[model samples]
Target: MPVVDIPGSKSITARALFLAAAADGVTTLRRPLRSDDTEGFAEGLAALGHRVGRTPDAWQVDGCPQGPPAREADVYCRDGATTARFLPTLAAAGHGTYRFDASPQMRRRPMLPLTRALRDLGVDLRHERAEGHHPLTVRAAGVEGGEVVLDAGQSSQYLTALLLLGPLTRKGLRIRVTDLVSVPYVEITIAMMRAFGVEVVRETVLGEDVFAVPPGGYRATSYAVEPDASTASYFFAAAAVTPGGEVTVPGLGEGALQGDLAFVDVLRRMGAEVSVRPDGTTVRGTGSLRGLTVNMRDISDTMPTLAAIAPFASGPVRIEDVANTRVKECDRLDACAENLRRLGADVRTGPDWIEIHPGASAAAGAEIKSYGDHRIVMSFAVAGLRVPGISFDDPGCVRKTFPGFHEAFAAVRAGLPG
Candidate 1:
């Protein structure tokens, strides 16, 4: 099988762009993801007058750790929520005001929480089209960051925006959070911000809804992105779905900074023989799939593959703690539930959860709709291998993360028994 390394996390890429734009002097990012989301971040940074140069190895981002975006930005964030969220705050910290536009898909995503929070923090930002969404105008103004509260359960990106930009604000932010989900992602942001010389201190919680970031700015340095553990779950899970073979993802060792790396434990729970190495991990199919109940608060992306493999299990596989799933590229819980039902699997969904009942093997090979979500396309495509000749429409949608997702699936599938 042809083995390839997926670029670093798109989440990391966005954070890196924000870091580069917010850092002093030049910063080099190694192995950044080069997808639409990251590209949009780069474009937005370029509009803000960061000399983000693309190289064969890594990107060289010339930057300044000071107030005001160096230039006028006519940014098209497209469907990248990170670009749509983080860039606005960075723009608010810049030299002059800029106009921010987005694609139709980007237009549909909510930016109100971040916007409202920014407005409360004294940002002179406005909505061009919808009040709470994209097509935003980032006016030149200083953010007087002090205390701000937001409903983070909708999406943790808002919290991330504040944390990343907290140091740049005049007062430095002390945030009070409510309904904050996807905390692992926030932890990643906190960890990465610390890596770049920013400080996010969490004091004793007054209640469950509060967090504190101490006053400090970010440091500039070279950084490398770990290979994507979330993408690796598919290949490892593929080994379990397709019997008689094992798949290994190298370079994803134990104790990764990315929270999505926890998917390895999920595969082990489902009866896959798992071995974790300092360099990577391997998963071999066990004799039978067992029932599982998992709360995927930290590792929601793994849900698609886990759910796809669920129908082969001995009983129901219940996935919980994924209210965050609803606000992803698409509604992953509904997508998994609805699509599995199409294949005659007993699937049920909730506002934020999913359950899959084991069932007979059926190769209907119907055209699966991706809804423009990459994980849905690949996870179901893996399930397609369980039934021969199953294919997907708009399979190219996987380029959002795992650019070679289809080819990688094919390479591994070609090695399996018929």
Candidate 2:
């Protein structure tokens, strides 16, 4: 058995940063993730004239109660979609102009839905390049925020951006969500907002989901981020793939805020034993991996983890209802099919689902192309635990979320029998 001390949640760290910056006083974030995405967000916040101090243990952010000091600022988001999508709304709360740019991969991701919602809230935004893409400009005099509708099918970050900015609006904020995917992430945003001393009212009105936020903005407080469940999925999948193997991810237990923690239930359904305590959660393989048909819409982040273990299972594995996964760091559905095929698995892919047949044998020293997606790299690494000669083309891409992923993974692999 290996105990993995995984990094903090990237989602929670990002949201906590945004909420802290918008709050009325200083906030301390303990054990926040120190990766490219979160660091990029911290940089963006600093560019807006907010003070961000870093220490070995925590990050102290001086909240901008009234608004950002810079009338105009250039925020570079790198490849972090969370930074690109969420920061624009925070910038809009200030009285100034903000230009946002991202890596080519992130620019290809959808931002039109969120930008459109900002425009509806009376923030002047212009897409400098093609429509719906990044390299956009936001000219802000603060948000009017009456009523707006957004299609959250592309990414839950869109709705989360609006909700984070809701309290700063003049008339408060009322949002109608249509085709909302990743509903659990929205819940995460609301929960974090509540911790920052803001309350978001969520209700269903005539079959549509609506969220209401009053004009009283956030108040700063100290917050601690839990270990990233999405990152923990790799080690958990390793345990499920290796017979009699067990891995414990501490600090992410029954009361964790991340929705991706539900991934353990998926492992449980696949014949793995799961134990949850207040301190941590552990998963052990039953020596028999059972393939299952599951809709991973809410927990789509773990699709690659499940796919990595699917080939080692006793039956066919069918993953469905994750069409939103197509628009992630890459077309993950296609990437999973191609990489699985490269590893000699009989994988079939549709517009939304992937069906992997039972038998999978490694093509001698199979090399997996990560397509610059961190999840793709980590997932395939889990498969390597079972099949020998598994290597990655772009192993460094894990730095986007977990900079020490390979090192941590090596620690887990050290416990595996040769």
Candidate 3:
């Protein structure tokens, strides 16, 4: 058995940083993910005059319930959507003039929904280049929160940003969401908010989902981040596609907070033996890979992971209801299809789905176009296991989430037999 020790969750670390910055005292976060995205978030906080201390294994953030200490700040949000979206929202709670910008790719992603809602709440915000896009400024006098409506169909990060800003307001926030995708991510945000001493009331009123967050901001505490389940999917997929191979990832058992952990069930349904215990989760290959259709709306981050291994399945593998993936680091549905065909798999992709047929091993060697998306590089690395001579155009893009992925994955591959 090959036990792959995965790193901490990026989503959890970002939220923890936000909560700690908003709390009333010092907050220590254990095993936080150190990546481009997270480091960018911490830097954004520091630029806004929040105190953050870092070590090899942990991070310490001093709370500021009165909001950011700086009266003027200019934050560059790199490629992290959480930093781009959440940091501006965090700055809105303070009395300052905060200018926010991002890289070309991050600048291209949508920011209208969250920015519109903030404006509706009496925030002075202006878009410098594009409307509802980055390169914006917030002349924050402070938020006196009230009922606001939102549409989170394109991404759930909008809802998460707003929810994080709720408690920092004077009157709290009652958000009425018109649409939502990746519901589990919102659940993660709400649960973490509860941990930081805020209870968000969620209910369905007249057939619409609503979240009511109370005022009186977060309370600082020590929090531990679990192993990233999405990152674990690549290793587990390696086990499922290799003959007589087994891989175990610790710290993502039954009670794991991330919905991406449910990717194991998808592997299990494809003829892999899965074991989820209190300590960890394990997947063992049965050497018979079957295929079926799976709806991956709530767990869409792992869509590329499954798509990469679909070429090895015995039947057609269809993944559906993941349109939001189009707005990720790249158009993931199309990216997966393009690479699958490059490897000689019969592949088709619609707006929200992709289907792959088996026996794609005919191609000799193909270089995968990474599109600067970490998931694209990491997912196809699983495909590289059974299919020989697979390479990447930009393997270093994994620095966005898992900086040491190539070495870690190479070590695991050395221990497993294909």
Candidate 4:
């Protein structure tokens, strides 16, 4: 087995950008993830007047709290959802019209709840094309902070939008969430904000999604983003499900704010040895894996890795508590099941759960389909190392998050052919 060390996560990078942009001083982020999404953020921040630079493994952002005064302008996020959602709210803070649009992929994402909530509180944004979806122009009417309900079950980005814009609003914002699925991501936003000198107080209402954010711009600070736990989950899974070996990931220790970091526990339960480090982490594969049942509500980003490794276990591996996985990049649960089935693993899936019967090794060189999802491709590609003749439909899709995912895979492989 080969040892692997991957770069940090885009999720952490994006959060770092938000924090850096809100801070008053220049923030330097080391090992920041580079991708279309992060680039879009840099572009969006530049549009709002923040000076940013995309350097090797790091980013420099100079933030001005009062600079991006909302103006009558449109910011096109292209295919970047973070940019599409977060930039509009930032723009709305100032007095002016701003329109947010995206490419075909991002254009299909639902934005109704955020828009409706903003409109209700007083954002002057209207869909130039279809309602709920993008291609809309904002008339820049400042929304007074008030109670707004959001259906975050579709995507956590909507909730993140409100949380990010909280400090800029005149009054503190309280959002009552209904059917919010990706609650962990909200916690991620809150944790990152607090690191950069902003805090969002969360009050849990049983059977409801309710969160509150105080009024104030994120206090500018030099905050470094933690390594991406989600990115490390795949390699950790690789170590666990393999016949023998280990993988070490740095910068993710015990009690990381990222919900996906909990995936290490899932690995340990499956009989893998996990070592936590101050700036990194390590995972060693146990010779054999026991099929386990798990709930993934908090660690949905690790769904692909867990599902890919499930078939290698001795018993049935069942993953539950994550219906939100259906919307990311693609219908991940459905896609993983379909592709794994193609590779000769027996798998069953539900709206919120998946049951996998582990017995045989994945077939070699099956030319699996990625469904245009980067996670699907990356996890399954790692699976291919164990299975003979493994290939992906769109090997290039990993650029969405890990721009050098293949290189990282190759880096870990040492001499293994890509």
Per-residue lDDT over 1-418 for candidate 2, one digit per residue giving the tens place of the 0 to 100 score? 7999999999999999999999999999999999999999999999999999999889999998556768989999999999999888899999999999999999999888998888878889999998988999988898877999999988899999999998888778999998798888899999999999888999999999999988878899999999999999999988888888999999999888888989999999999999988999999988898989999999999999999889999999999999999999999999999999988899999988999988778766999989999999999999998778889899999999999999999999999655
lDDT of each: 0.79, 0.91, 0.94, 0.77
Off by over 4 Å in 4: 1-5, 67-72, 205-209, 360-363, 414-418
Per-residue CA lDDT of model 4 for 253-278, tens digit only, reads: 76676788778888888888878766
Candidate 1 residues 163-215, lDDT tens each? 88888877788888877777788988988988888767775465655666655
What total of clashing residue pairs does each candidate reach? 6, 0, 0, 16
TM-score of each: 0.95, 0.99, 0.99, 0.92
TM for candidate 4 is 0.92
Q: Residue 232: error of model 3 in Å?
A: 0.6
What lDDT is obtained when candidate 3 is compared to the true structure?
0.94
Lowest lDDT sum, 10 consecutive residues, model 2, at 63-72
lDDT of 2 at 374: 100
Which model, 1 or 2, shows the larger TM-score?
2
Give stretches of model 3 more than 4 Å off: none
